[model samples]
Target: MNEPEAVDDLIADLPEWATTEEIADTMRVKPQTVLKWNKEYGLKTVAVGTRVRRYRKKDFREFLLRSAEATD
Candidate 1:
């Protein structure tokens, strides 16, 4: 891939402090799923502002790694 494409891919892979909607779009999952995960797993998150929720990059990476370990 070109430089820009590589950068975009990296950005996609990196954890972004994004809303449930954004996370759903990126993960190809539903927004409800994200909410459910938070409720069920006590996943770390932050409130950006009024009615705005976001996940940190480190939290997302750790979650992914944990899931992968479970599967393995």
Candidate 2:
């Protein structure tokens, strides 16, 4: 598959609500980097409880697409 399709397929496999570790694993970054993205970039997350945060798969997909387009 082409790059975009491959990216889509990868994103499609993510859970509806992904954890910091899951996002980091998918992007091949550290979990701390994912948290940094949330702080610096526009990666949004939802707080589940006092100490749990979950990222929306759709938001992550959009972020990846935007980043790819920016590099091109």
Candidate 3:
């Protein structure tokens, strides 16, 4: 597969334990943008202690579903 296809596959198969940076890098968005989505969209997240935030792979899927629905 080409690089873009490999990236799509990687995102599709992402693990729940992956970090926000990993998601940001894969999606080509800023880390702050991802954090903003967590705050603004109520995207599912977990805290490692107090200050650190991590998003679930399921939330990413849900975001995609919501976006698709909105576009339709």
Candidate 4:
């Protein structure tokens, strides 16, 4: 039998969390818009120190879905 080769995990290479700028780019909006949503919609974030914050990939994806549905 041929030996199996190790493969890289493409999804794993992707960030487990996203920054505000990243989310804004994905949403086709400005970074400040992401911040606004964070406040008005109660979108969640994790504080990485006392200064930096991150949003979970899953949570931000869900936020996109819910916001899209709301517009329809």
Best by TM-score: 2
Model 3 Cα lDDT, one tens digit per residue, 6-68: 445657757876578877887789988878878887667889998777778767666655654
State the weakest 10-residue window (summed lDDT) of model 2. Answer: 1-10
lDDT of 4 by residue, 1-72 (tens): 111121112122336687887777665789889888988987888888876779987676556556646666
Q: Which residue pairs does candidate 3 place in steric collision?
A: none
TM-score of each: 0.66, 0.80, 0.69, 0.67
Give a tens-digit lDDT track for model 2, residues 31-51.
Answer: 999999888887899988877
Q: Where does the lowest 10-residue lDDT sum fall in candidate 4?
A: 1-10
> Per-residue error at 60 for model 2, in Å?
0.6
Clashing pairs in 4: none
Clashing pairs in 2: none
Number of clashing residue pairs, candidate 1:
0
lDDT of 2: 0.84
Error in Å for residue 18 of model 2: 0.5
Give stretches of model 1 more than 4 Å off.
1-15, 48-50
Q: Could you give candidate 1's per-residue lDDT for residues 1-72 as a string of tens digits?
A: 124444355447545677788767777889998888777866577877767888876575566555545556
Better of 1 and 2 by TM-score: 2
Candidate 3, residue 55: the lDDT equals 75
What are the per-model numbers of colliding residue pairs?
A: 0, 0, 0, 0
Overall lDDT per candidate, in order of appearance? 0.67, 0.84, 0.70, 0.67
